[model samples]
Target: MNGLGYEKMEKYYLTNLNDLLLCMKKAINFINPEIEYHHQQVAYLSYKIGIQMGMLEEELKDLLIAAMLHDVGSIAFGEELEILNEGDRANAHAYAAYKLLEKFNQFAYVASIIKYHHLPWNHGSGRSFDNERVMDQSHIINLADKVVVRLNRNKPIINQVNRIKHYVSNNKGSLFADRVVDAFMEISEKESLWLYLAYYPDSINDIMEYILRDNRLTVDDVVSLTDIFARIIDFRSPFTAMHSAGVAAAAVEIARHAGFSSNECKMMKIAGNLHDLGKLKTPKEILEKNSSLSEEEYNIMKEHSFYTYMALKDVSGFEEITKWAAFHHEKMNGNGYPFHLKAEMLPIGARVMAVADIFTAITEDRPYRKGMAKNDALKVIIDKTNDGDISKYISTILIKYFDEVVSMREKAADKAIKTYKSFTEQMKISQEDVFAMVAEKSES
Candidate 1:
């Protein structure tokens, strides 16, 4: 406890909040890899526009976060992807993005910007919505998003500049704010902005680093954000409502029993929460299916752990965390879908994570089948442990204090279910305002 205990640890999760946002986007891009990515380009365009508008440094910071995640709420399997390509017009995703992101104080202004990113100016009438002030930065995201969508990625970017500029100019004071358009028009004159945008994700990191040099996050903040990640990953289906939360709880207690320090236990929780982040790539139909998957569907499912690795591998402080999360499916006998590391290669932390994952999963009820009772579930764990797959030592620890571990796991599942209900409630809020706005224009 003396080494990395809570009191002595100051910067265990110390990270530029900017880095976390990019890592989140990596999980999201898995929604559809074949499509052209726009979040980074939109962030870069919005950054340039924010500077041209002379916004405060703090404003630019939130603006960048908002721009990168403007379309985050639309992350679903199939139809949602098409909706984005066709343009949302603040009708659905923008407000939904707000509902999901507003949970974190770190995304305070960022939530607001994403909520109104698709709101039209309506000839300057867009300054406020629902009697609350709309941040001007939202309009910058709106304009940037539109510009990126209008670009034909198949052609060289320079050739498409004029057409994109014309759309912005044509929508001035209607679809876009005057100030934002004026900024875009000025920047559009420089051909370099378009070229850089074509290939600027690495540079976006540099920009975010500069803007966030003074604003590092605490461990608690990072943990709260991971809770958000779990919600995003599991919210797609009711059967998985609290799967990640349960795993995190089971992992924390199991790691503690295995003599991991408090801070190390916290890292286990992060690993558990993010272990299923790749499931976002799994189709919704597959996720919600009430029957066993065919081999083809199972093959698709196997890819998620691999993608989970790819998404989290690059995040700062997640090197060990990534393996712990991604290796939950790996076997000590060298039989995993994505990576086949043998017993010698598997770390103790990764071993704890795998057992935690199995324990929580077998105990939790899903729509398709009833969860196993204590004896039944423990038997499953024991069989796997004896087969030289999962860690026998961790399995023994889990069974030693099974009741207390079950209590903690149930409490975590209960908390996560509440969050899922809250999100569904938030998701139900009507998206009629944009429709009404459209109707008004036709009448006039």
Candidate 2:
């Protein structure tokens, strides 16, 4: 890595512990502005409860950090299910949240909270390995999160307050920790806390700064945020979990062997991760289908690249990066969909993305088919070279490094499912909590 590349990576992921927290803060703000530093409320409530129960400052900060990332999975859920009815929304949000956080070992505990945020505490009673720390904070975040959701949506104030009270009462030992309920009950009695916690103006940047100050996030934090965003694209479909990562790995390796500048290769990595953001709009069934697709379904699949390009086309700092991500589908002869970008219009980085995309697809196992072996996969690419689709020169370099590229395809395929076992245990919270919270709010 060049000095500049090293600097960017350090700023985001490899950093001092203080820097990581700061990054998390900024990421939360960018990804969920509507919540408007609502993570701070979760942090505040979690800290206060931790303190009331005599936990140390360091422990409280850990809880606070976890709270900031609590709803991060929601970003992974994308735009479609985010608009679903209340019950589906809860499940979608919590599942998406868990899948996103579980990638980093540092935040696995926090991921547990996001997973179980909607579950009742007692749901795991039969399991000997049930985690106690996660149970407590999950309840705390769920309660705090509900208050924010209701208030922001302009739900009746008195009703929201009573709902909080009743939710705690109904699932004391089952969905919530007994002590957590005690603390929430005390806090619910103070009406002003809810008002202060929920209030926010229209500006997203304002909320971003608020979260940064409270959590100490910094610009370097965007690295984690970027990874989170990349994961979001894959999470929209089970077939795509490692899609970006594989594309990135393959593109970077091919770039190196092909003698591209280090800067160009770095850009390639970012492009590979973002190339499929448009796939978030495609229905999961269409993307995962094994049999021949209907023309209608095939037509929907083609729109994903267009959606990706449009979404990032206006985002600053993504000028060059967006091309590689969105142009991968374009053919050298100008027969591609979306923009139908021609060969001369396509940049070297985009060409690399196209190569990486094709190589990864053939080598990785699909829902209906086992992975094509490396030699067989290479033969397919070579045939494309003969057809004048993929360039002969770049195809040669890619096939030369086929061993490395196939390894990436293997690694990525393994992680494509977006499955989190721990979260399944936590999903139970939402079933009971939603029913209880709604009924309680109705009665009050």
Best by lDDT: 1
The C-alpha RMSD of each candidate to the native structure, in angstroms, is 2.9, 7.2
Question: Lowest-scoring 10 consecutive residues by lDDT in candidate 1?
Answer: 76-85
> How many angstroms is residue 122 displaced in model 2 relative to the true structure, after the best TM-score fit?
10
lDDT of each structure?
0.79, 0.62
* TM-score to true structure, per model: 0.90, 0.63
- Model 1, span 365-440: residue lDDT tens: 7877877899999899999988988988889999998998999999999887887776556555545556666554
Candidate 2 lDDT over residue span 1-444, tens digit each: 233353345334322334334433443344445443666666555655665666655555556666666666565554454521245456557656766766655567767766666554454441222344454566666555554555543654655777657765886666556777787677667666566554532232343334334443223333344566666666555566567777878887887777766656666776777788677667668877878899999998898888778765654455777788889888787778778777899877788888899988877766567778877887899888777677666788887777877776566555544342234345456445455544433222
Badly placed stretches (over 4 Å) of model 2 are 1-99, 102-140, 148-205, 213-238, 261-266, 311-316, 373-383, 386-388, 415-444
